[model samples]
Target: MGQREQVATSLAAAVGEEIGALLAPVDAELLRHYPGDPATRQPVHTVYVPGDTFTAGTVRSWGDQALAALDEHAPDAASLAAVLGLAGELAEPVYARVRAKLEREPVEDLRVDFEDGYGHRPDAEEDEAAARAARLIAEADRAGTAAPYTGIRMKCLEAPVRDRGIRTLDVFLSGLMEAGGLPGGLVLTLPKVTYAEQVTAMVRLLEAFEAAHGLAPGRLGFEIQIETGQAILAADGTATVARMIRAAGGRATGLHYGTFDYSACLGVSAAYQASDHPAADHAKAIMQVAAAGTGVRVSDGSTNVLPVGPAERVHEAWRLHYGLTRRALARAYYQGWDMHPGHLPTRYAAVFAFYREGYEQAAARLARYADRAGGDVLDEPATARALAGHLLRGLDCGALDPDEVATATEGLTRADLEGFAVPRPGV
Candidate 1:
């Protein structure tokens, strides 16, 4: 058995086995915790409505208001293209998809914000609001009108508000159970987290809640809001974001950047605070790197500019939001926060345009890669995964139809792309 080949070396195959044994623990840990992006639909954007203001119809109302703004300002594809400077090829398709998305699903992921969007109300007042929000979310779920993901962003775990935040989350989850049961897409957010211990506290809180409710151990998950400088780096100059992820104990679903909060924390003035600011980029860059293979999605923060004035002012705001959204997409941040109804139009426009603009090229590359055919740009396994992922994102966001993707990618289904895009185990 290969005597001539084996006679040249004294080393045996046992050495290879020994090496695998040495790395087995690390391999298992990475496979279990860092299995890559979940094979689920990631909403393009998350809209946060103040807890006290959220209603059963808030999702629909946002959609309607966004559509009304579109009708009033950019009434047609051509007008929208002019406002956002969409290319000639992207004009009709992107505009039509954005409008349809507004009508069909304006807000993909929604958070009833009890943090900054909601200030300190009295104890009873916050409790009532939290309960009311849960009831409304449950009703929306039952009525089949809920956003794909819906939940609350309780106040931070800082000293002054820690008990209040915990109580509010308790009331919200209890109210949801009372109304019916926890909706499938339940999301919770703990904001202004300054340390990894805060994340651990959150994990314990959820664990207790799960135990009390007789739910599965990891049935609940939440996003860690990165609103403070300390969340990115500790006083000892360590990368705290990575530590927070480990502290989450598998319940962390996302890392949501808070642009204005982070900017102010870094001493940026209100006028200069933005998602694209250098300070914001630097913080998010750290978040991106830390979350990279951890199954924790990173979402960019929002712009505060509201398109609520004259047509010209609205156009200017739209241009700003659209550009920022596009920039985030290019940087691999697939989701962001949208604060107002007016922001919806531009948020969707940017997302649709981003996906639609690159659909055909990505599809062709993926198809060629699938066939092992060489093209001008020679693709590798990692690039093939990215190309397949691009097409999948387009399909998930409704920018590209299933029929269109099937035609372009040579009969590859969503499942096929999912298989192609999944992370491979390190050998």
Candidate 2:
């Protein structure tokens, strides 16, 4: 072997030590606050249904309804591709995968909405609804028919509804306890979170529940909805979103954009309010930045345009929804909201197509990067991680298969891909 080459340095060892000492605290802060992405499969979208209307059969019913819509309108791969303006090459694969996904696991993350979706109601009515939601969710979990993740979105922690929200949450959790025990996939959302103090309150609330029930400490986590402007930027002109994440004390799982509420708050006209609007993009960009490396994922909001009415009208709505979902995926917002069962077909269509279209190229890049085999493109560590993550997400969502990923990733197993994809400390 050839002798190693030596590099000369003029600086003294003490000089380097001085700089290291100065930056030690900042390095620790970054590790504590921005520790990179979690090694778990985040669902592609969250489907929200009213708490009062939800039942144990809701998940299956929604799948059947969406399948019915597919049968009625785009009955074949060619038709679905034509309706969504998907490329010819992607038609067969995307269509097959979407159908399989709907049949196997229709809903991923589901929220039994007790807030806007359910609306204000009598105390007795809301209380019963909350308890029923818990019971049904528990039954679904035992039956293996529940969504991968399921929970409720309670009312805001504002002064007007704070007590009511707490009570509803308590009733629901108690119901779950009575039914059996909390499922592993339990999730909660604290909506309209306009203050950091509310997040702290949520932390305390969960701690109290854990103490009472003898559950493990930090057993529960929640999502904070970015609705009002104050949630993103405060009166003091600082990035309030970052502060809110910190206030959660490490239990914040996500930051969901409330498209309609946020747009209305900004005074955007109803007709012009949309996920792609400049104002919406601005807010999401801030949310995106604030969540980076914090293990807090960001999700896009939904469109109110439901795919209903005649086949022609449904097709039009499908086109719009597919376009928006694809756009969000391109922007790295992997999750969004699905308001109706009819939106499910186009939702899966977009996701399947996005991953299928780019599958080969991404897989090839990853394989080459892993082997250190030079290719037409030179990928850095971050890009390699992204490529690995892309394939993993596609696999998780059924856009790609295990054999396909394994072969294209140059013999990398699922475990290998996952190991390589996770960001290294202090990177």
Q: Pick the candidate with the highest lDDT.
A: 2
Q: Give a tens-digit lDDT track for model 1, residues 139-170.
A: 88999999999999999888999999999999
Reference-based lDDT, residue 15, model 1: 97
Error of 2 at 383 (Å): 0.3
**Per-residue lDDT of model 2, residues 97-179, tens digit only:** 88888899999999999999999999999999999999899999998888999999999999999988999999999999999
After superposition, the stretches of candidate 1 with alpha carbons farther than 4 Å from their true spots are 1-10, 425-427
Q: What is the total number of backbone clashes in candidate 2? A: 0
| TM-scores for candidates 1 onward, in order | 0.97, 0.97
RMSD of each: 2.1, 1.5
TM-score of 2: 0.97
Candidate 2 lowest-lDDT run of ten: 418-427
- Residue pairs with backbone atoms closer than 3 Å in model 2 (clashes): none
Q: What value of lDDT does candidate 2 attain over all alpha carbons? A: 0.92
